[model samples]
Target chain A: MLRSLLEFSGINPLRLRMSWVSASEGKKFADVITEITKELQEIGPQQSYIREAV
Target chain B: MNVQKLKEEAARALGRKDVKYLIGYKKGSYGFRVSPAFIEPKEDIDQLIMSPLCNMSLVKYVMMEETLPGLTEQALKPSKIAIVARGCDSRAINLLIEEKGVPRDRLYIIGVSCQGVIDQRKIEARFPQVTEPAEVTEENGNYIITVQGQSHTVPKEELLAELCTVCRYPTPLIYDKLIGDKLAARPFHYDEIAAFEALPLEERLAYWQQQFSKCVRCYACRNVCPRWYSTICSLDSLSPQWLRRSADTSENFMFQIIRTFHLAGRCIGCGECERVCPMNLPLMKLNRKLEKDAKELFNYESGKDPKAKSLLTTFHTEDPQGFIL
Candidate 1:
């Protein structure tokens, strides 16, 4: 719902990501962060939702 | 519809020696307002009235009394509280009981079969200048609103609340003495949600940003929520403030997200949060989105079955895990 709300407000929801990272899964955690970074890069900056007046 | 019978039931409940008081609706001081009335004595039952305008959830008051400070178990004798419950209010009561927020034994529920409630905002907008108290009665799908000794009849659809229009449960799911005949449950409809879901991500984000930007963060939505029974809300923690006092869009978004997430499987869809909202934010859309997703993803509906545990609390191996990755 939050993601949808953000998306509705014209923000790039891909900028936010959630993943299950276990204590011992160091490699998996690194892979998740790398994937999210790539995704955010592709989405570019969040605009429109953030008003200029504010 | 039968005011006499309703008053009679309230009188009987209030007459009970063990009943602390009866919480119901009464005529407001001014036009079209239905205030929650606390009936302690049998004589006070006469003041109780049930109408299309009695849309306020009484379950919040029950939760309030349960958490009231200085009311230790030994301080006051344990007594049952008789409450006039509509469909949503009963569900809230059941949810509270299931969550162990309130004891089931401490309530005497008098259920009223609702035919949808009128939106006060809509009514006030229609009749903007009525300062004196007005009486509105429903008849043959029309609201006969009398203001200043002049009667004007309006179609029910013109004033019916959006939530009520799509309400599935019109009769109380749990009640000791049901007053009116049970109403047939409406079929589920998610057209609004589907339309929103079909929108492109950017547009969706833009729409919510605009709505959320106007939020004043009054916390009325949290305060009116029957399930928000916690003594200290997570949003109000001083050690780590989840939400800042600044009413900026980003912080407001965070506040809304946190609040809605807390009610993921617990919101009863009473629409009180949206009704109490001063800014008239479409809070129900966010809540109903969760409701829709919870139903589709987990095959769960909150406050429907009293026997079932909350969705987040209980888990099965076969539960949908598509989002886990």
Candidate 2:
């Protein structure tokens, strides 16, 4: 279902990844998001669900 | 209708060499109340009876009973206890076995083809002061109740439990001995959930928020729910703290959300949580809505198959995903 959601958003499959987060792992979640954001930027702005700033 | 046949089957099961005590319903201390009966001997099976008043789901005993006191190491093997299960109770039993909470070999079920049980609240509202034990017998579409030597006949619809009124399965799904034939299936509908869905999002959120704000962190809902029985309740863990100890609104909302989501595709719509609620919150509404959504979106019904994986645990590649946003 998560993959389906990502696919529907027109996100590139190779750039996105999944990670598990425990309640005590705030830093881990933050770090994963940071890495994912950088990777997304490296992949450049592809035409996707988000058209503009909300 | 076949009360005697049920008792006989229970007796036969109890008399089996490998069988332990059979669990059924007995009279409660007050009116319209039923208590769990643990029948051991064949003679004791005579106490086993089924009626509209016998609404307590016997499936809970599968997971609720404490291990026998000071048993020898050899005696620690799982006991094969028999259960007399109604439609909803049978589903719960199957859920327990599916989740591996109870071993399949440890259960012997005498499935009763239920004609729907009565709601104690409705009965009490109609016939109060049944201080002594009462009898509920079915006769020609009506339940005849006798208390303190006075008899009253009420139409079944008037006292039918809220869950039973909307029940789809009147027959037990699994059993060792079938006591009676199945009833005609009712038209399955989720009108209550539809009504709730028709509400505006703000109103719906507000409605739940208001109800959840009243929660006292009593844990009665979790304690009474057959599915919520894990070695440790998710709410109790300190590392994650899914729910905080304080009874404030923010924590209460989180608690209710997590609890309800955990039961998303698993609740049998037993109405136990609603009945056990001291504050009379409509907990079943939230549960029934989830049950409805599961049916509509995933075409999934919990406890129908012992081998089937849970809805949330196994996701389909083509599952509806656009609604998540």
Candidate 3:
């Protein structure tokens, strides 16, 4: 629903991704993270949507 | 609808022993404005009026009234309050009851069947500099507007509020006493949201970015929301994760988008936020998009079913997992 909201607001919904992996399955977690990171690289930073208040 | 009949009903509610006062629309001080009138028992109900110009949802006032616990200066709070409701306002009341904000028994609903309301800005723009008080009546797809002893006819489509154009419900869903004829509602439509969805992702972002940039961070949109009067409102917290007071794009987007999410399954599409917005933002776009998605994806429509649990409140094992991997 969060992803849907982001897309509705014109932000790339790809910025949000959720996955479920067992606690012991470190390999599966690492693989999922890498896949999301690749997708984020293509989608780029949500530059227009987010500017951290730093 | 007969104004006299509405006034008589208002008098009846005001005369109730438990009802503190009755709230209805009265003629505004100036042109094309309708003010919410609070009536006492002995007061004249003749002041009450309902026309296409009464464009706001009165449900917010019922919630805001609670914040004024001792408004009457009496030791005991008023047991019940009477309010005039349109179709959307009735929906809002039901949503409030579903959220347990206000008890249904504590309210005396005077539901008025609404055909549509006029957009004040649209009408004012169309007829600039009409300082005199104006009156409006709907007649056969046109508005018979009378101002300063001159009557003019304008097509309803030219001044009808945007949300009213696509309203699926024009008759109040709940009421102790109903006034006027029950109106036949238009079938559900989300053509605009569908078209917006077809646009490129970047284009959609650009469009909303421009709109959000125009936002001054005036909380009128927040303040006017019927579902916004919670004890622990999320965005105003001192926590770093919450939205700050600044009017930058990041903060504006955060405030508007996050607020929209909070109102996901509760918004009745009253168009109050968009109407009260100083920047004239298309605030309804975010709301209607979610409304469309909730209907299409979850088969849920807010304010349609009073007995059913709210969309966010209830969960099912069969809920869609397509978004998750």
Candidate 4:
């Protein structure tokens, strides 16, 4: 719900990312891109739904 | 039955040369309030009492002992502080141990089998302007309260704290001495959070906005959190401040998220944050939501074991990559 809100307000959900950065894993990036893409899809077409919502 | 035996056991523990003190509860000056008592002598054991009013989580003071500033030279070592801990308080101890915040040997915990504590707010609401000291005892199905020389039989539902509704662990997981009969653990339920989430997105945002606006940036929630005792909190880090000092909607939102995220896998569901919040924000809604997510996604529960690592800190090779890629 919150991601959609930000995305609807023209803020890129992809930009406002939350990642679990491990202190031990300094440079592990095997799944960073995939995670970003997945989050983007979840933030789907919020402009229409959010407008109706607001 | 168990209360007296518990006192005898504590007195025995205190008699030992190595034992420093026994922490217990005593009657407070006001209605439905209990204060922590540090008993070093056998006579002081009589002053301790446990009732529905003894809702305080004494695990916080385990790390609260006064320590000297910055000098590597030690004048004295840490004392073994024995405390009366309930289920939730025991979890705090476990969390501290998990984070290496406190050594296990240094703590002598007298664990109590908790029967859900009363919500002081609820009781106060039902009996406002109470001047005299009062008592709340659990009976067959109701709480018998004696306030101002009048006895009132209140329904359990009216005085029970919301966290008690879904508590799955009523008895302490770890203890050196035990108190009270072990009650059966209840099941976890997120009915309140689910109901809140059922609201429309706009309404949900509005509800949160109203709640967040009332926040005075007192940091009471942060101060009371057992998991948030970093010498330098991330919120105060100037190198790259994640949250701005300004108390605007954006900043408040960021602060809340940051606080919740920090406790993603570390929150023990003690409800201390909600209890200490002066604004009375439904902060637990956010926390329980994250807790529910962490449970579903990782199959993990925080503070279950001291040796267990935090979810964020520990990752698996077969970690779900579907979310990112």
DockQ winner among the candidates?
3
Task: Compute DockQ for each candidate against the true complex.
Answer: 0.41, 0.05, 0.71, 0.09
What fraction of correct interface contacts does each candidate retain?
0.40, 0.00, 0.75, 0.00
Question: Positional deviation of B320 in candidate 1, in angstroms?
Answer: 0.7
Root-mean-square deviation of Cα positions for candidate 3 versus the true structure, in angstroms: 2.0
TM-score ranking from best to worst?
3, 1, 4, 2
Give the local distance difference test score of model 2. 0.76
True lDDT of residue B273, candidate 3: 94
Better of 3 and 4 by TM-score: 3
User: Candidate 4, residues A25-45: lDDT per residue as tens digits?
Assistant: 656553665766677788774
Q: Candidates 2 and 3: which is better by TM-score?
A: 3
**iRMS of candidate 1, one decimal?**
3.4
Instruction: Name the better of 2 and 4 by lDDT.
Output: 2
Instruction: Give the Å shift of residue B145 in candidate 1.
Output: 1.3
- Interface RMSDs of the predictions, in order, are 3.4, 11.9, 1.5, 8.1
Between prediction 1 and prediction 4, the one with superior lDDT is 1
lDDT of 4 at B238: 85
TM-score of the second chain for every model: 0.98, 0.93, 0.96, 0.92
Give one digit per residue, the lDDT tens place, for model 1 in B1-325. 7789988888888777878888999989988888999878745567888889887999999888878788877654547999999998888988898899888889999999999999999999999978888888899999999999999999999999999988989999999889889888788777898888788875677777788889999899999999898887778887787667788888788888888888888998999999999999999888888888788878888888778898889889998665555
Off by over 4 Å in 1: A1-13, A16-24, A48-54
Candidate 4 residue-wise lDDT, B194-300, digit = tens: 67656766666667667777777778888888777777887888888766677765567667766777777778888989988988977787888777767766788
